[model samples]
Target chain A: MRNDGETIELIERLARLVTNEGHAHGLKPAQWEALRYLARANRFSRTPGGLTAYLGLTKGTVSQTLMSLERAGLVEKTANPGDARSVQLGLTEKGRALLPLDGMATIQKAFEALPQPLRATLGDGVAALVTSALAARSGRAFGICHDCRHFAADARGPGQHYCRLLKQPLEDAEAEQICQEQEAA
Target chain B: MRNDGETIELIERLARLVTNEGHAHGLKPAQWEALRYLARANRFSRTPGGLTAYLGLTKGTVSQTLMSLERAGLVEKTANPGDARSVQLGLTEKGRALLPLDGMATIQKAFEALPQPLRATLGDGVAALVTSALAARSGRAFGICHDCRHFAADARGPGQHYCRLLKQPLEDAEAEQICQEQEAA
Candidate 1:
């Protein structure tokens, strides 16, 4: 409901990106999706809970991805001794083994193929943007620009502040919108 | 492995982008991940094969996403008339109903949030980029530049040509690499 067209497009582009990389890396898109979540996850089983919140999907979907990954030995699921209702998710040796950790040659080849300037331009900028976006999702309010933070007042003029990382300003309205990240930053 | 620290960083960043959006949309990351894939799908059903190729997700992983979406009534599965062995994936009315078609509002809001120059600099450029990216992926090519009709060898330079749409020069090596997209494109 809160998602606008631009947000949707951004989401789709991101998804395509993930799909492309995951497939190229020989991992399922879901596996990649799950893996990505796991990479950011604090606890293993909590991964599913995060997936449920971020995707607007059902518990069953999360369960299925976890199940398959577990079966393939890409991830391991263990009973949560602390929480009887939850299970922990973590990467298996095989899963980690299959993942070139750094990603396989194709990914490197892709990077190598790019011109140095292009690589520099896209590489750092994209990485920084991703990090900022990811961090924003954590529940804690990011304390960079007061007005720019989502909690800041937006009734004022232009209602936007420049982001050092993005090297651009976001609308005041956008700042007010909650970031979807799971943990508190 | 060929993945440079930068490339992994970029990919991880993209993942964060996904997580951020998922959190904002009140969708769990995994559910949102599935939704993102479904939106990019050609057909409503968006066969597991298509997902496999497009998202780089494994069969099992895609299957799980599909199964979950199906359970949620966001997507439905129908037998592939052409290939009895396969099933065509299609979005449910519910799914289609949730999607933001062009994302104009979000873009407009985002654009308005920026400085006049930044808006001007990125406005048309971003739109064109998205269009080119989408057009290039019309289920014909795998979103590769070379395979795109716009991709042409520069008559003046051995590896130089202009992407008719992006209006950028395309080098020969870059063009060749993009050819991989043609297989899926």
Candidate 2:
């Protein structure tokens, strides 16, 4: 059996191999992660605090990354209705256009190259480990809004969905996004 | 079954979660990865070129990281007897001592907290994925010297090991370390 230390090292190296990509785009790995999260995160979950938690990074680092994204015209700050002092982030059209060139594409291609059967098993195994890690740290489990306990479907029509926790209506595509406030059903 | 997109995101987030933990230390995630590699690598694998291929990053980034590590007194450069222009890296007293506080330990702990059976499976599965990724990229598969096809047992005595590729004797413990040139037997 492979030792736990060796196992951890394997995980670490895999992480590095994937994360180390995308530097060619002039964006750091952290920035790419932030951009990807911002793209998939719902409007309510697009704040810096939400990103900091989701990325498991310090507020300082997140703040700097956001600043750079803004300077590069890839991200824009919008006023938050809930808090006057806080702002929500959204990707500019330029950001959306550039995502296709993301370094993550390389990893996605690598992942796809795996035998199809192993893909699902590896996914489930990895998701379980993430849950365990969050549980150990008492950290939040960020997940898709559609999967959350608060998600109520058919609020208005067959395709319409609602968030019971936030008491907000979700657009068809938005409901499928990741949310900072997601709670397991 | 979980979709492939979600699976990729899961792997990405888990990587972020574990890698983000060690930022509490002054080192960047890349630096920590480099430090960890240096610690486990055999003397032959301690050069910057070996690290670049192992990391799949550009030589420029690796060079900058090494410079920072040297400035911090964590890594020291030593002359290469075979090639005067090239240098090999060795961890200094400070470098070796600081490893205990590596953010990687946080990941190691999280990996250990996983159910016993799952850990091995996860390790093997991850290893397979990495191998697949490397194959897809035509990248190097850096591994422990002991497992390399070139590894020879009892070349001089029962405890003595030899690296046929380099035609050199390996100390008992060094044979178990990672080698840049390692190949499957």
Best by lDDT: 2
Each prediction's DockQ against the real complex: 0.12, 0.63
What TM-score does structure 2 among the candidates reach? 0.92
Candidate 2 falls in which docking quality class? medium
Which parts of model 1 have CA positions greater than 4 angstroms off?
Answer: A1-101, A104-109, A131-185, B1-11, B23-30, B100-141, B144-185
Please provide, for model 2 over B1-185, each residue's C-alpha lDDT reduced to its tens digit, 9 standing for 90 to 100: 57999988988888777777657578887788788889999998899999998988889989999999999999999999989988999899999998899976766777777787777778777888888778877888888888889999888898798999999999899988999899988
Q: Write the per-residue lDDT of candidate 2 for residues A26-142, one digit (tens) a residue.
A: 989888888898889998889999998887767998999999999999999999987898998999999888888998888788788878767777787798888877777778888
Docking class for candidate 1: incorrect
Runs of candidate 2 with Cα error greater than 4 angstroms are: none
- Provide the lowest-lDDT 10-residue window in model 1 chain A: A139-148
Candidates' chain B TM-scores in the order shown: 0.51, 0.95
Candidate 1 lDDT tens digits, B1-185: 11256354455445444443454334454555556555553332256776665554578977887787788888787887667999877667877776653232332343355444433333333233334444444432344455567666674577676666555676665564322234322
A33-114: candidate 1 lDDT, tens digit per residue: 5665554443322456756654435789878878888877788877887578776777777766665542323444544555
Weakest ten-residue segment in model 2 chain B by summed lDDT: B16-25
In model 2, pairs of residues that clash are none
